[model samples]
Target: MINLAARDILHGWGKFLFTGIGLGLLIGTTLTMAGVFRGMVDDAQVLIDNSGADLWVVQQGTLGPYAEPSSIRDDVWRGIAGLPGVAETGNAAYLTIQMAHAGRESRVMIVGMDVDRPGRPGAPGYLTAGRPILHGHYEAIADERTGLQLGERVRLRRHEYTVVGLTRRMVSSSGDPMIFVSLKDAQEIQFLKDNDALVNERARTAANPAFNRPGVPGLLEAAQASSGQSRNVNAVLVRLEPGANPDAVAGEIQRWKRLTAYTREQMEDILVAKLIATSAKQIGMFLIILAVVTAAIIAFIIYTMTMAKLREIAVLKLIGAQNRTIAMMILQQALSLGLLGFLVGRASAGLWGPAFPKYVLLLPGDAIGGFMVVMVISALASVVAIRAALAIDPAEAIGG
Candidate 1:
């Protein structure tokens, strides 16, 4: 009537507990890997949702600002604005640039938006502090992750702007903080050149026979002026009327405007499936390898633990203990070990997730899935130890 499993575990508590801890750490890494993948997908979805745009109009035959380099004339929005089912359209320019703040430079996605309309497409979904960009000149808004406070001036390219507002969770697809500036300033920073380069370019153009022809009175001057200006934006964000079909509006723009247009769903596919697919696969492979390693360690530990109790197992078999009872003892012990490991892993992942630079969204469902997987693997691993224990001859107990 003795509880053989409990007695054995208690007798070697050190080995059992330490072995469980080692396995638990591996399980924790596996869980964290899955969480990292989920976080990336969630961040991509949030980016699309916060844009408040049903359709994204980009350059012809190319992905938008998130996936590739897309350049559309700044005035392209006017054409899409006049389309059917379009409730409103906003001109948005996105350029990734390094800006200096507090004597350190951090990579940021500079978003150019219209300050006149506070609730337009491409504006921050919500603010944590200060106000939205109310002026179009030298004021700026930044994500809280950038560590920039209100009234602080940051230098970008050739101009300096003061941070007048702060928002939360506003990040680029790469997890870089987003800094918002006026369309004019962003354009300048996007295509600005040094004074020396500008003067040299002017001299080169004026020396051209075609531009300096006598019949063309203002040809050289006009060419130089045009070359120094940037009149293009990355993409246009469009918000359709309520219940308007985004697919139809996108089709219309692609056909008439000869440009590529993507609905929210399409853009999400590009970001999640195309942009981050390889990284996701890499994480998945790591999870698989970790699971294998965890299972191997558990099997070896359990087999070794069971082997140490050979005398007890032999005596139990000789004293009328059924084979099922011995097998169940091993199975129960394996499952218990798995449960302990899972708890440790879940707690560890939660503790370290926030400290990660990128967003680490650990969902409850994923944690539950991880627990199930560990238990199954542990059960499979116990098979080897169970078989080995069951093979021990009952006669061994009597030293025969």
Candidate 2:
């Protein structure tokens, strides 16, 4: 028997090929949506991994610093460091803000770590360029995504910092690039008030009779000076000893220290499951809508093609073509169009993935699943055209 599907497609190859390309662009957008979701997940995972902490110790009754605003006294790490199975503890302060650099503003997460002591939990895992922050006050190590080069100065609140080092893939759960500064600077930036506010605070403290009683001049000065500094940190990053159980250590910190401690796994759950849950749902809804639209387009295109060839279909019916054979031919054409679209979409996604501002991770598993979904949609969409072709009268060929 002659291949009816191939013959029909060859006869109108221009329309078929262009229609496939148009459908392919839509498929590419769908793939890109999936990639955006995947990138968010990867960004969250990278944040957890790059922290290099076995446990995160934050204020009691709160999630970690990334998910919530957690403030604990900087000295809390000293107590946590002495706990059993605690090899080392580092105080960390986190603040997300818009940072200005070289005539542009970028959203960045400023991390304050003990840069004086290398290999601390909160420090950048590695630097791709220059050197780490050695100075306590103004030196910074920034993720390359922030577009900061070596010796470039960026202001954070009250002080300017020189970008001494650059790192890769160091971002917050929200995909904001990270800038590492000294613990003291981070504390001041996150907790301290501006100069005018500081003056007003000092006057307010001085006006209070509690500190300004007769013959208590020194006492009032002490109160004013202490109120001007910030000794608070967002969280304490803890590294456990070899073979230490993270859960046990976290429990001890929660019980004795009266603070919230999260093990690595639990923290991952908070960041991935809780932090990005809404975004994931939005992406899922988009995928469903795109699938429906794709199915609709396939059905419309195939139905129109079938209608345009009613005379040919009638001729085939008059020439002893089985209904099963006619149905198979339509199905084949739908599948072929879908196959072409999928190939073009996959290639387009790869070519344009990096052009996106945020990360777009196109996984092979997603691609495979997408291919299967497209084929199924194509098969289902052919039903409308198949029914129309089958309902035609064979006598229409002779009359027309």
Best by lDDT: 2
User: Once model 2 is optimally superposed onto the true structure by TM-score, how far is the C-alpha of residue 144 displaced, in angstroms?
Assistant: 1.1
In the predicted model 2, the residue pairs found to clash are: none
What is candidate 1's lDDT per residue for 50-120, written digit by digit as tens? 78899999999899879999998989988999999998888888988887777777888899987778788
| TM-scores vs. true structure, each candidate | 0.95, 0.95
TM-score of 1: 0.95
lDDT of 2 by residue, 358-396 (tens): 789999999999999999999999999999999999999
Residue 362 in candidate 2, Cα distance off native in Å: 0.8
lDDT of 2: 0.92
User: Lowest-scoring 10 consecutive residues by lDDT in candidate 2?
Assistant: 186-195
Per candidate, the number of residue pairs that clash is 0, 0
